[model samples]
Target: MAPVALIACFPCRHSKRRCDKSLPTCQLCIRKGVDCCYPKRRAQKYIVLPESNGVTKDTVPTGNDSSINRAGGSNRSSEWDQQSPLEVSYATPSVIQSFGTATAIQFIAPSIFREAFLEIPRINIAIPSEVAAHTGEFDQIRDISATFFSQVVIWTPVIFRKNFFNIALNPLSPRRTEGILLSLCMKLYCTPAAQDHRDGRTALYKATKQFYCEVEAAGIMSVCILQSAILIAIYEIGHAIYPAAYLTVGACARYGIALGLDKLLVDLTGENNAGRPWMEVEEMRRVWWGILILDRFLNLTNPLRGLTTKDPEYDDYLPVDDWTFLNATAKPQDNLKISAAFNLKMGVFTRLAQATYLVNQALKFVSSLPPPSDSDTVDIGKDTAQLRRTIWALISVTKTEFDAHDLATCCQTAISYCAILLLQDCHWRRVRISSTEDAYKHMFAESECVLQNLALLAICLRKDAEEGKSLGEEFPVFLMQIVYQGALTTIEMGQGSPNEEIQERVAQYKWLLQHLQSRWRVAGIYLSILQSKEAIMASIA
Candidate 1:
């Protein structure tokens, strides 16, 4: 065999070991757990060139020659010997074309970018100094009052509603119990005073007129009835005091010849009245009667001057001298004189009377409930017991001295108690429902009603506070804190649900927070002003 030059070999073949000749797989493949192979290369066959008509004899290179020149001017090996390092250059046609096109175009002056960078100064513009100052003041005032009114209205309802709802749902709420007691107190004292006070009666009359007008505009006939009733009570009080102030008394008297008490009594009790079915109704009637009695007592001639110092117990039933023009007149047990005296004193008696009536009515209703035959009876029984206690507490307040300041306090206290009672009623309604779904529905409804009443109470309390009357010293602050805290807590807890109901509740809470902040701010401002005044006075002194 002819000796052949070794080209590329596998690792095993290079070591003089056996080659597997497995095409791609070799001996090394077995050891490395892989496949390896060599490719077949085709060999070129050499052909002797024939001398042709145009061929030259010296064209081909001879073997073992250093330099053999050919007709083509170079040998194949010489060409290989003349080879140098490879040179490479790159050109991007797209980029080059883009640059060429850009260069061909005319450059525009004041390009968008250039204009943006070289704008003229705005020095020509000037704002008036006064306008600027006014702008700042307007902004400050806007900021201060921006959320004030909105927060006031929104938060007032939210807090009141939440507190009312929670208390109403809570069968054992202390607040509810307290409310009942407070209502009783106001009925006994505040009702009578409010009935007699000319200012208070006038305010009520004006408020009622406004309420009626609004209700009529809205076409809410049900609400109109309530307003009318309130008006009737107001008119009755007015006529009992100053007959001159009772121009409408004649109109009211068309239903009845005297003060319309008989008509009111008939309206309150029908043939089927069968005693007070609802304690609230009875209490309301009692309040009405109480104010009337108190008003008549005040109208007695010289009652304030000690001319008619009859037995205090029989004051409600007695007729004193008719000193309408400050002239002494001997009147013999005149019913008109008795009625007039009660009217004069009605200012100090109205509120207390109303509160008393409401409490007694509530208590009477509770007492009228059938005895509980089962576990459900326990709840009803407890509510009735609590309600009675509340009524008694309210009634106890009536026995105290009736003064303006005391009367206002009593009203505030009574309103608070009424709020609690409403809450209790809501809670009981929830419990009475048979199913969870029904319970939730009833709960929400009752909650809304309780909330509205609570809001009204808050408004009343606010009005009382504004009048520079005592909210029982620490009581107002305590009540406010309790109500605010309770409302916030309920909102936080109730906001877990992602439903529409919960969303609305959260919105209400946000409104309440903003309202509270505004109120606190106002209160703070008031305190600051007061302090500043005191400091100035001290400095002057």
Candidate 2:
């Protein structure tokens, strides 16, 4: 037979392209976006092939028979199922090496500590050469102030998170930070300048404004840091100078308004309806208002000096009535009324307490001075007597409005303050004491008072909880827990002491913790009941 030629499909042959031969649209037609044309064809009948050899009709294989044999043997086929040379085991050598390198890098470059001490940029204020050239005393003050600012940066975030989450964040750390900052600020104010008053005021204004701005921007974790910074600025300005600028009522009002603290309070408590029942919000507002009032009183310009003032600008921003908003929003119930009245009364007492504290601080500062050799030891006995009288008077004022419950609560706060003072005094005395016995006695006495106050506070808290009163209700449970912890601390401090007073103090602290724990457990149950009721209502809705 002559050699046969294969013909291409009509579309491919016409377009001068290769045909795929298996589809309605050939590869060329599909690629070009043209319709594929196919010629009509009739179905052909299959014909059987003749035997290749005549060994036997059954042994001779035809084309169709070969195809059938190949199909039947497919299950046993090896050629199609063979693995390629490129195929490798699950654990490849290259993959193992790659993973090992990654693991080694991780071990070598641990990021934990590196990230922790990362430095952040901070604002730098230039001090004049003359100002910086002050005594070593000024350097010490600067170091303390700087340390406080750094701490504020560190702690601001922590406090914000705690407050925002309504968690039991410790106030002591922030309080300590604030104290240190305040001390530093006092030192700054004391640095004598040609224009001491104006310069001191300007420095204070700048520092306080910066502190406020930093705090707002820093978020919850930086709360302690910011608080410390603020305290530092306040303290430096208030105490550094002989006549403190911050001590004046006008200065206080100006500082408060400038900081926009009133608005900040609303911003903080307004979200999530934190101050629910309206009364709670009102109470908080009153607390902040009182704080502002105290701040103003402590400033250099006394707004309350008289109705008339030299500067009209000073009185422009002052709130018309400090307690009006609070009074108007208070709940009508007798209990809330009593609570509101007590809070106001306590607010006044707190101001007196602060004054007492300030006076004591001033006395201590004065006493630290070396007595003139010819001046007969510079007797401050009269001054000390007056301070004692003032303390008693303040205590009396606090007692006047106190019920059995409120009195106990007030005692708790007052005692805590006393404990802090005593602790500080003990630390100072440790360096100067001649008799260890006397020092131990004083320490034990202070520790005992702290425990007693905590016990009294816990008892009052329990009573209030039982009566469905709101005092301390919004405060974190950790606060109560810490009160118990404080008692434990006292007990621990008194252990292994030879003095009888110390032993008694230890015993009292243990008893206080035990009683407090029992009361707290009951309070927890009440909280659980309230939570369950809320859950039930939610489910029904």
Candidate 3:
């Protein structure tokens, strides 16, 4: 008889396309939501044997039950039958190379896995010879460092400008960590200019890799290296490669824990003071804050993933004001005055950090609950009440300390507002699942809070637009996210209410979203959503 050839399943066969011949089912059938059926198989009796090439070939099992059982042929057949095309493609190679003791496939399996799962194609970026040749150029290093400090340092003040410049421009010796930081700094600084200068951004990216290799070669751990890791994470975030950014921050956190940076030092004497400079201790704290900010934002944006610092049980003090940090050797009284001068700025950063921390804590608490039951309803209620109180207190305090006109202050205010929406969304979901309430009064209140904050955001953006100030340069991506949420909230508030205030707020939000259309893609998306009167009216009704 002719050899029985493998055939496609019904779905693939009917569709007139190639099939992977997956037993029982195939990817196309699974994706198309259809039943997969194959033709009946013929019974055969054959043998299996292991070869000298570390390969195994199988034939149909013979009629001896004991022999079939001992060979475990049934289980092998079942596993093969269940295997997907991807799995089969991974395991069986068309050709294998044998070295003295090792058998190698022509292709690496992990690359195939990445291609299949992540769908991120690999692209090789050629490093220019001049970047390597100009590694020691003082002017080039200074220019790049200056660009970073001038543009990016205002938002993130972890690096001391003078000290960074001195280290990078040193002729006799240059620190590997500092070089790495400078490369990352250049990458971040060049990002905004990328639209105009793609080649420059590419060069900076290549230079960053070169510097990162140098840091790896040195294999030294210090505060500066930690700073380099943070900057690299920030660079990755700006570039919107979130998974890479997440991994970078995870590495930073682990390295930090190993170095005792996460531990709150109760004793400042003895080993702590023996040789460690005060500057180093303070810098470590600042770096910790940086890590916390990055971690919180990561979790906020991608809540489904594992968070690096879930609760941040450590008691590291918040970073001091910029002037106090810069004047490390200043007198206590002088530092106090500077702190007072920047107290509002300091409070804005600190309060936002605390709000983010509390949000994360609340999420962790909610996520830890057992699936809803009659007995758990009361406990959920109490927890929900406590969270509401905490959120309210944060909003009240932010209001009292509000800087209505400052861009950073307004940006954070928008976050505080958006958090209300997220909190209520969580609350309503659990309440409905638990069958606890038919109506939630808090939902209306939370929606109003969102509208108010969005109005405030609109005012802030309007002010900036009036002054011709561009938020495109230093605006955090999350601010655009806040704007997006605000647009939705405005629609919710204005839907059925014929109240003029509601209409006015909705119009203001629409204008703000439209104005930001040229800034970020998010703005355009929100603008389009708000522009749809039909959708808004339908949703409202």
Candidate 4:
């Protein structure tokens, strides 16, 4: 067969979406339930006419082809055409040769290198140069970079501080686009730009998002691009930017897949990893884990939505301490270590990974349970019961260790409690709980556990609040979802019995939600849900 031809359906053309150009229908069109049609006029769009003059009557397809003028004889088409090749693999034969006989891949044939590493294809894009357009802007860039690292680093420690600064400080440095985009992100987030647009997105947000889209559209797959996109997704989530936030995570999922960051990581193994530095591999692992964390946290409450990032495998390595990882010298992996297990000595990120794992396991366990119906009893299954016990035990211990721990830990503990409550609540509904006083008491205890954990989150947040700090600023935005669930659960338990303790807990949940709204707009969404529930409860009371 001849090389496949690329064409965009009219719908994709109008909507400004990527056209996979699949026969019958493109994926985006299929998603939107729209007709996919390729107009014959576009055939003339790509037809190349030989040029003896200053301009050629030819056009090349790109993300934004309207900007391309055929009369200008723009040679950009050849550079950006879909078939253009990108040199994505870092370890080439020449680079490996420098490591001498010590490098495992040095002696291996080039064919083996081709087989081991997949090169991501390239599409050329015009990187937005707002931050880098001037020589004098480096000082502002450095100043803005300070705001993101301190607390946001705890949420996802994917971007190394020194690497970011080196690229950021030296605007003319290699990988200039990465530096530019990162600087743009820092500037926007430092003193968040006012939402001047009617759509509620700031000018800075639009610029950063535009830069992100252009890079993604042009098939630029790098950790820098992924980190920028992930940061944008976090911003969307915190401010309750829907559909965009949801779609951004999905986009990052695709980007991570393209980078081969999530699965069958060849660079991480001791056998074939070859001459790549250990920190490089660690960065790879951290990026993958970061995706997993974001995906889980985004859908922690609504398991039905499923996960965008890959599920953590049995042999996956958890990150070492953030402090050590950031500051320490390179250590050769030469071995795959650190399975997903708990240790008190581990960093906050590791605890987050472990806690997130519990949530994922709970979701999987719940899937095994039969759907709810008019049944007196439901089988918990042997394996699932074992899993539930493990989750409960972990939550209990975290609860015991919860003294003066940071908000992230409290977020972890709170979510873990939410996870078990989710598992148990599905099979053991309120009607079933009232089946016996003991049953009711058991259910009540579980709610109280989750409620107290949520309350502790509020209390922990208050310290920062007392110091005139932003509530939920350092924590993941999906903590808003977990807090909402806590408030909802407290109300339900209170309705079951008008207990003073439950009511006091209800007040604490409200206060937490109220304070959290200062930092995360998603809190306002959940707070409204709580109000509606309270109104219904009052009428029924």
Full-model lDDT for every candidate: 0.31, 0.34, 0.50, 0.57
- The number of residue pairs in model 4 that clash at the backbone is 0
Off by over 4 Å in 2: 1-257, 260-325, 329-383, 403-405, 411-420, 423-501, 510-541
Better-scoring candidate (TM-score), 3 or 4: 4
Between candidates 2 and 4, the lDDT winner: 4
Rank by lDDT (best first): 4, 3, 2, 1
TM per prediction: 0.21, 0.28, 0.59, 0.69
lDDT of 4 by residue, 297-369 (tens): 6775567787776667656667666666677553544223335355345565666667677788877766556
Q: Quote the lDDT for 79 in model 1.
A: 21
lDDT, residue 6, candidate 3: 78
lDDT of 2: 0.34
Q: How well is each residue in 1-541 modelled by candidate 3, as lDDT tens digits?
A: 3332377654464457777777657767778676655544534222232234657532322221110011112332332223211122111221111110111111234332212211111111122344434443556666656666565233345665545554455432223234435545554444542444422234565566566555434333455667777876765665544467789889888866645566522222112223344554555655666777677666654455677763654242455565666656522232122112222445344555555655666556655656665555534445556665666666665566545545333434555555666555555555552211232343646555655656776787787778988755555555666666665544544444435765676677677656644433345555666667527555545
Candidate 1 to truth, TM? 0.21
- Candidate 1 local lDDT, 1-541, one digit each (tens): 3333233223343235565554445545567553232323322111112233334221211111111111122223322222211111122433233322222221232232121111111000122233223223323323322322232111111112222222223333322221121112112112222424433344433443443343223221211122133334433332233442233323323222112223224344322223322322232233334333223222221122211111212123222221311122222222222223423333222333333334434433543555444554445434555554544444344535533233223442333344344334434443554332443444433234434433544555555657765443222121332234223323332323334653444344334333332222222222343335434434543
Q: Which candidate has the highest TM-score of all?
A: 4
Tens digits of per-residue lDDT, candidate 2, 1-541, equal 3332234444454445677654555666677665554533322111111123323211111111101011121222122122121111132333233323322322354232122111111111222222223212333544544443333121111122222112111211212222222333433333322244433344543454454343333221122233333344333332233243233333334333333334423253332233233433333333334344234223212222331112212111222122333244323221122112323443432333243333334334443545335444433333343444444444455655655455433432443334233333434333333343444444433344445555555566565656777453113222333343454344334332425654454344344333333323323332344335434534543
- Positional deviation of 471 in candidate 1, in angstroms? 9.3
Worst 10 residues of 1 by lDDT: 116-125
